[model samples]
Target: MSRGHRLALAILLLTAATAPVGTAPVTANAGDGALVTAVPNPTADGDAGEYAVVRVPTASTANWTLDDGERVVAVPTDRPAARVALTATPNATRRLTDVPVVAVPALALSNAGERLRLRRNGAAAAALTYRDAPEGDRLVRTDDGTAWRPLGYQPRDVHRYGPATVTGFVLPDSPSLPVETLRSARRRLLLAGYTLTSSRVVDALIAAHRRGVAVRVLVDAEPVGGRTARGAAALDRLAAAGVDVRALGGPRARFDYHHPKYAVVDDRALVLTENWKPAGVGGRSSRGWGVVVDSAPVAADLAALFRADAGWRDALPWRRFRRGKTFAPGASAEGSYPSRFEPTETTAAGVRVLTAPGNAESALVGVIDGADDRVDVIQPTVGRRDGPLLRATIRAAERGVRVRILVSGAWYVAEENAALVEWLNGLAERRDLPLTARVAEPAGRYEKIHAKGVVADGVVVVGSLNWNENAVSENREVALAVRSDALAAYFRETFVADWQGRGRVGRTTWVVVAGALAALVLAVVVARKTIRFA
Candidate 1:
């Protein structure tokens, strides 16, 4: 059977739903933020046990109750239902008896479908309903109660249109502002990105920290560093406010730059193509795509990733930015081009994640290899001619597939992409391939195309992975490869608008003409030199 056929069968089997796996707990990051992590019971000699950890951020004299749909699991009799602190408790595992409760019903939770709810002063604070959970694993909220994900302990098969839903964002077109959505971070917030000078986003993190929320930020150290860099200044400001801010790539750094643009708020993960800078997400700046995913597994995986990067280790040593470091001002957007298109969204399934300093290139290559028809790509720029991804695109075109690449036409991007366009056209002609490439016109409101995405044969891959070797091999990156024609079509629509600007010569056609003129000039120079020698 075809891949699609097999995927459909798998989803069908999941819908049948056997006796639900061990009760999957629902934990929300907002409201009275709750955490349900699986830890080894010290009393049980390292065997696993579920700990219902709750955080009441406010000072309250009211009681809170934990219910598993049927009966009251545990109720705290003391004032201030749970720990209300800015930091996580030292040890998360607690026995049922440890809870300061008035009474406890059957302590052992049901393994089948159960609606776990948390109520504060008789008001619903947060709740999670789960079914068919894997054994020995714990479910936690990546955002509010709306999204839940299992901690990513091992690789999982892609679920076809699984329970996960993907919400997309195109800058300046999103219904609500990105910063507005970010302000909802209630429990713990983790942010990782290359550049972050946006006052709105930075202020949000600072405010969340002051409000006693656990907030941590990790950013690239080099380009965004120095006493003059705006990003550095922002980091310093956040650090001063008691927010744990670390710079990736110290002297003994593993990656060139920590370039993943994402934020994990509660149980939700916001993956974006734009940075947290003004020119990135500002309504009338660069054109890009952002994806909001509420999957417990994905959120847990990203959270684990953030911890690993933020923690001090021998291999990837991180340096925390100290206060008083003079930081440069933010970038100026004096000559930004107008955006031609607006933001749009589409749902997708079978989403495969790719992380860098890992096997991101291989995963992307695998997707490209699967394309049988057309492939459309949009990126800020392509760095190397012989990069694995670039070569793969060329090879795909050699196989008679129509391949078109669109890169930004902004001043910073135009130079690099010019050489790339010329190189791709040359290869296509020499190999007689059906490959074409273009640089987006800076005519519209969209000054640049910062999005790094691909649409190929009923699949859509979008996120912060740039079209460069450093991004693939040396920098931290996150990408989502989705298997859905609806998503693919949405991207293809943007690619077409960018590829066809007002009265412009095709990249391949113009490159051919430019090549001919250059060749003629070189031939004349050679003839003159030969005559002089004679």
Candidate 2:
């Protein structure tokens, strides 16, 4: 009777759909000008866990100050958005609503110079344009210099993805660029109703500010602060360089907002990846690819969720986000990658194939309910309690879904979630279920295989969050779902190599976990054989 785990599913659904769980609401940094507001969550630093709306405000007449006492003024207010550059205070644990701690997401959006025009019903709904947009609420017009465009959107009711399903996404880029990803996320948001933001993003704003890229970031109204908010620093830097920085308003949350990691670059490319901070490109992050899709419906959906220039005057800011005539669409070169992503209109309902942090929970049900053939899961950690997610996996296997899981191999750490590893295996044997499990041994450098993805027939989910329930409900997490095989195969191959204990050697790519010890032994054996032969 592997039914829908009705009680568990219902409880999970109810919990996710439930509004905030009685946390105090505080507005710390309330300011004027064009502001992007995001419901700030508890700082991941394990401090006093406070939540507020980040009121980052930027305008021509604005002067900015950050938590680190960093100040920037008279900066150029034209170009891409930038984070205020501020130094983190030493061991500062008290959460500050107006502490002016901006954020920097993990991976900034990718820009390929190529642009696209997104239209609905013949009239242009949004355009994939980029350029020097000022730090105020405005639009960047087309080359013809005719009409204006508005980049900001109003805030709406926010919902978590689902129980254990992070009803959220990640927006990790600079203010203006990050704004683009927020805009892109709007659609999924409108349809699904969730919140999203990122870390590496705040860094982008800082970089943009330093480079004289006119910057302004609008975060959720809630002002949540962490130890080091690179976004705030970027905002400070941009203000110092004469760029106006601003923030808006949001509802205060009792708990922290942890799941957000997506980026939109110059409103050109929308990037979905898991590399945050050291986890992104040019860092020690695991093997991950950033997919930059061309779509405006995506951007518009995100923009709709933000409280658009609501705090500032309705003046044209620059050449891109300004409310104006649509730019000509770019060439529609076929995407070499695979995508079965159906347009919103064509997608079917009741498949209940929702995507989000909560997906971790849904993955089990997603497979149990729909996986008629197989279910393959890969997570660095799978804890006990037979979480709704794990239970779903076991149930699917029991029902003949060929539930197979590949847990990451902690080549170095002794208790590297090995307990959970043994537990997953036990789950299979205890139930005598036809489930298969494997440990992906490390292939190289002190790098423990950290790819968290799952494959259920045609559905694929990928991101940085672990499979553990803690990640589902606690940590800041983000993941993307793809119904394409091409993408799945790529992920599968990488997983296989790690499990086979074969590091595809390249330059000093990454350090192998204690597997390095194995290399040492191999070298010794070869040396001994040569001496004996000689």
Candidate 3:
């Protein structure tokens, strides 16, 4: 028999076996066990695509009815103590969830606010009420069934790790740290990132795969500016070498972007604010911060995160995803810089792994709010002026904690960054607060600021969380909060160097300055000759 027919036969047998024999149906009053557990808003054509979940305390729900104030429909399940979905469209609803679905042709849920109740033989067993529903979101009851809230796309929880040794490094200074760490993997390696085009890293992964290391990679299916030919080629190379590579994204993707940068190598975890591109991990352009933690718990937590992200429905194998897809040609970063800071080994008293679309914003804001001495923020850019993070920083400054924000000086954001800095400085001067902001002057150190980092007191935050609402609320970003004075000092030193523009003049900076001066001299000579002729 076909699958559908088999399912029907199974349901019929279950119903016949579980149905109550010849007794009268029991009527339930208030405080009974049946409850409306969840309701999903209509995201498709009409109300038929929506569903309401009911949980019962007994095996059979033959006597239960769902009343939505406007109309009543009988609960259609003989399964006991199970969570079942009552929908007008069973086949479509089954595709969204694993719960048993029963088609109730008379069932219809409104998008606007409504009150629903579970009735047993005409008596109300439990009741649930909700306001207007959010598009594509589900309203679910609490475990105790006392409260209800909208369910978002949060899949991972905020994880914490106890004291352990961490090796911290800054990019363009210790580019070999990540590659060497990857090469040291013995049993397994799980790498996740927004993009991967670094040849050095790819070679290390291939070598690890060849030596029987179970190497797997997960990256964004569609990175900013789309996938590049070099990135696609790198992924193909890894797949050819028996490495498992998958990309995360699709119409039903849980995150706006899978943009975390980290790798799990056996019992060690490497987290960074950089992508897997030449400008980031290869240490050629962008200045970024990273850490390699030597703790089994940390590595295990990161490994779990990788599996959860990669095992989702949206994750597609590299070969399958590349079919009929086109890639754009992109240039690789070739800039080199002097090593101003070396990797440092330190011990954090505690470490917390923060991820986006759930706990990252509040956790990061807590970091700023807990600042007692100073808060130094380094980012490509921040969110709006009145955003939560900025507001928290301002509050910290008000409480006498010095706050300094350094933003990117890249041309694309230079104008707005300058404006924000001026506004912040103006507010500081007017209010007599210890708040300041500045645009980074790459000043020959590296290219522009690409680090999303903060050094507050003795704690340092390093990872790929951009200080914006969308990044914190929608994207799949990861960051680490390491409470170690040594690590904080290392990142603080680099932040100070970039903030003060104290690095030696890079060749490009010198050439630009020289060209401008030469142009000024020519203008002066022309003006003098014109005056003499007149």
The candidate that achieves the highest TM-score relative to the unseen native structure: 3
Q: What Cα-based lDDT does every candidate model obtain?
A: 0.62, 0.37, 0.79
- Candidate 3: tens digits of C-alpha lDDT, residues 92-193: 787666678888888877666666777766766656555555545564322222222223343456788899999999998889999999999999999999
Instruction: Give the candidates in order of TM-score, highest first.
Output: 3, 1, 2
Query: Poorest 10 consecutive residues of model 3 by lDDT?
Result: 10-19
For candidate 2, write residues 147-249 as lDDT tens digits.
1112122212222221111111211111133233434332122111012123344444555555654344433222233213333333344345544433332
Q: How do the predictions measure up, each by TM-score?
A: 0.61, 0.44, 0.82
Q: For all candidates, what are the clash counts?
A: 21, 126, 1
RMSD of 2: 21.3
Residue 169 accuracy (lDDT) in model 3: 94
Candidate 1 Cα errors over 4 Å, as ranges: 1-163, 210-212, 224-229, 313-320, 323-325, 334-346, 502-508, 511-534
Error of 1 at 493 (Å): 1.2
